[model samples]
Target chain A: MTDPVVKATALRKCYGDLCAVDGVDFEIGRGECFGLLGPNGAGKTTTVKMLTCALPVTGGDLTVEGLSVKEDPRAIKYLLGVCPQEVNLDPDFSVVKNLVVYSRYYDIPRAEAEKRAAELIARFHLHDKLERPVEDLSGGMKKRLLLARALINRPRLLVLDEPTTGLDPQSRRQIWQEVRDMKKNGLTTLLTTHYIEEAELLCDRLVIMDNGRIIEQGTPRQLIEKHLPGGGNLEDVFLKLTGKHLRDE
Target chain B: MNNSLAGSLSYRAWYMWRRNVDVSLVTWKTNVLPPLLEPVLYILAFGFGLGAYVQQISYAGRAWDYLAFMAPGMVAVGVMFHSVFDTMYGAFVRLRYQKTFDALITTPLSPEDILAGEILSGATKGLFAGAAILLVVTLFGLAQYPSSLLILPLSALAGLLFASFGLYFAALAPYIDNLNLPVFLFINPMFLFSGTFFPLDGLPAWVRLLAELLPLTHLVNITRAATLGLLSPSLGWDLLYLVLLTPAVAWLAIAKMKARLIK
Candidate 1:
């Protein structure tokens, strides 16, 4: 698809003998909002970890921004932003310092990094909390700050692992606006989520994976139309995509 | 193209050094102050009360007083212990509870850079504590050997070596219970047996050799040589010992971190 910006072929990840990802092949176009829609334990996070070089690929080949993660993980990481599900901010550092030190880890120039951080903080409506500690912030403020910190490097590809989970409605809407802004700015996103509505609203195209493999792939409208008449709802679509078997995992 | 790991490691070390200084100030109460009180007690207990009874540094080849000879060694020991403790506890907390390394692995920084930066921060903490102890030593007129200035840098190096070892423990520490074993088995034993309080020369030959095998031995020896002005034993060998051990420990730490990161 238009010379994919990210190409993962036969990506296989195993935790010991348990194959978490089994021969999954996928691609994401430049500036495309791609979604990996799945239930829990559906290999979405495992794939994300492999894509971001956070987890070792037992057997596979993957590339991000035309760079091979195997050969150039550091360079690829430089061009990618990851908003993890867990907000692991340094509580000791002030908001500004949190952004500041994080940027330094990427070898981003201090002056430029600080300036960019200030601009992002202002843009994200977090200017007042610049001097505040992380533990003192509201849940929503912390979530937004997490996203801001992720985007501090202005990455080419944004990989979000359940980016919107555990957010209040207002915070979710705020995050949705930021994600939309990222898409409008032509930043490609590879998002993983169990929320069918999030995938429907935000994703341009999607894949529904179960048991470490993509069972179906197409635009959200396409999957809804081809599988369900009238393309009315996603809960029915998800049920049809997956069986009634409860995912205890 | 010269893409040596050191280029990146050094850059990260410098970068992390800057961040840690900022953090050190923010948590100055937690990171810097607790370490401050620790040495004050050690100096008071050993130098004030014990110094009177054991006031003769006969082995130091003069009657300078035990505190005078031990003060520099204590500073070295403080830097070593505190740096190692700071790194292990901070890194273990980050690795286990905070998952900071999990977050950092997603960035452009490699495992080597993370290890280098963390170890550098530990060394910086050591320098801070060592400097504070030096001030106290100066106020009491306890510093006899003028060459002890070199001990500061030597202690910093030794601090890094110990912190590297600490980072290795942290990388492997999978749980809270697993965390305590290393400090108990490895760190405390090194402290007691490193000849921190007593002379190693009088120990059994194998015991002395085991002490020599540890990093603290080289550290305390250098500091003692500096404070007592006893360089006839060769400072170059001491420096060589630290030089050789520093990279090895740092490399092990990096390798362990890299293994852990490839999750």
Candidate 2:
């Protein structure tokens, strides 16, 4: 197997008296779609935030591309692209302007930013609404734009937090198809979700998490065979591991 | 980036400022007119309307036109008002309601860069407002000195100072309603007592001492001196006061905002 792109040892995050993430360990290999499966308050978002440098790790050794998150968060940020769980697009800007302005943070030249923005807009099927404000877009369109934006810097690793949550099946499939296409082009993804089907369809290997700890891990098929002996999928395995139904938060 | 002063600043901050500018340009028709006209209205009411009855006034041992005296103070007021609102309300909307800062933090941009960009953008708005007042005063023939051109740079400095104050207060504010405390208690007091509408000489001794401590008082002094071509003994002190206080407040603003934005 290729070297891991991300490695964590005893990862932890504490909020005053509450320990949101506690002593979790995992490794995500290069070019692999690694799923972090958990129920609400399982510290999924906190772990992701730590990885993205949005929050400092309280205690742990977490590294991306051999650079420590604690020591070099700014450098790690350049190698990764993030699609947050919430829709945080600029409401005042148009579809085109939103992408164009975002590219500037990377110091992308004007001509290059324009070209890449157009390409992503076309790829995401935002051609018709290039001039329309972000508030005008449908739920699915905004998610697609978020995906397109995450790819603007041509990052090697993509971090998606509940990427397809609340989307209609059609929109979900559209995103799935895009993820598949990007994976085929050798993209690495770290996805967190409660969706069993999404995890099964996309992730090569995953770890089931509960109470800030990894309970079980392996390929989807391995997890099924190891946990649910008779017959089942990731959802059945999740239930067997956590013993609680996963509900939307 | 390191926590040092130079390390906190980045060229990427210009991009953040550019984002605000781009959005501002889209609403230019609506945004441009208010800053331009509000000062003119203030000029008409205070400079022209009040000046007719007040006639000449003795300011700093010299007799001067009341309109000319008040005009520069209005310019300083516009810069302070615009910068404070931009950093306080405008920054708040992006921070809480819009979640723009959250989106920005995910990128290569650091919290310091975001705060710096905000400071720059707020200052730009203040400069715009100050320039508008300068134009009105010039057309109204209240500006007599070639030194009036210095008002633009002076207002820019005033803009930076007030913007820092706004951002610092925003860091401590919990909700939209909480912002009212600073606006009323801090900003309003500065606006009324900074000699924007009247001479500070006649105010009580304690009041003058209190005004001397406010940042706007120094800014108003420099602005009036620059516009009227009358150099006070305190002009050097005024410039030095603003120059030193600006960076100190700016550093505090950035550190405070970083705490709020970075978690």
The number of the candidate with the highest lDDT is: 2
Report the Cα RMSD per candidate: 2.6, 1.8
TM-score of 2: 0.96
True-vs-predicted CA distance for residue A23, candidate 1, Å: 1.4
| Clashes by residue pair, model 2 | none
Off by over 4 Å in 1: A230-232, B1-10, B60-64, B201-209
Residues B180-231 of candidate 2 have per-residue lDDT tens digits of: 9998998989888998888899999999999999889888888888778876
lDDT of 2 at B235: 88
DockQ of each: 0.57, 0.66
What is the CA-based DockQ of model 2? 0.66
TM-score of chain A of 2: 0.96
Q: Please give, for residues B46-144, the per-residue lDDT of candidate 1 as tens digits.
A: 877898888775555455677776677677778877788777788788776777877887887666667688898888888877878877877877654
Candidate 2 chain B has its poorest 10 consecutive residues by lDDT at B1-10
For every model shown, what is its TM-score relative to the native structure? Answer: 0.93, 0.96
Q: What share of the true interface contacts does each candidate keep?
A: 0.69, 0.59
The 10-residue segment with the lowest total lDDT in model 2 chain A: A240-249
- CAPRI class of candidate 1: medium
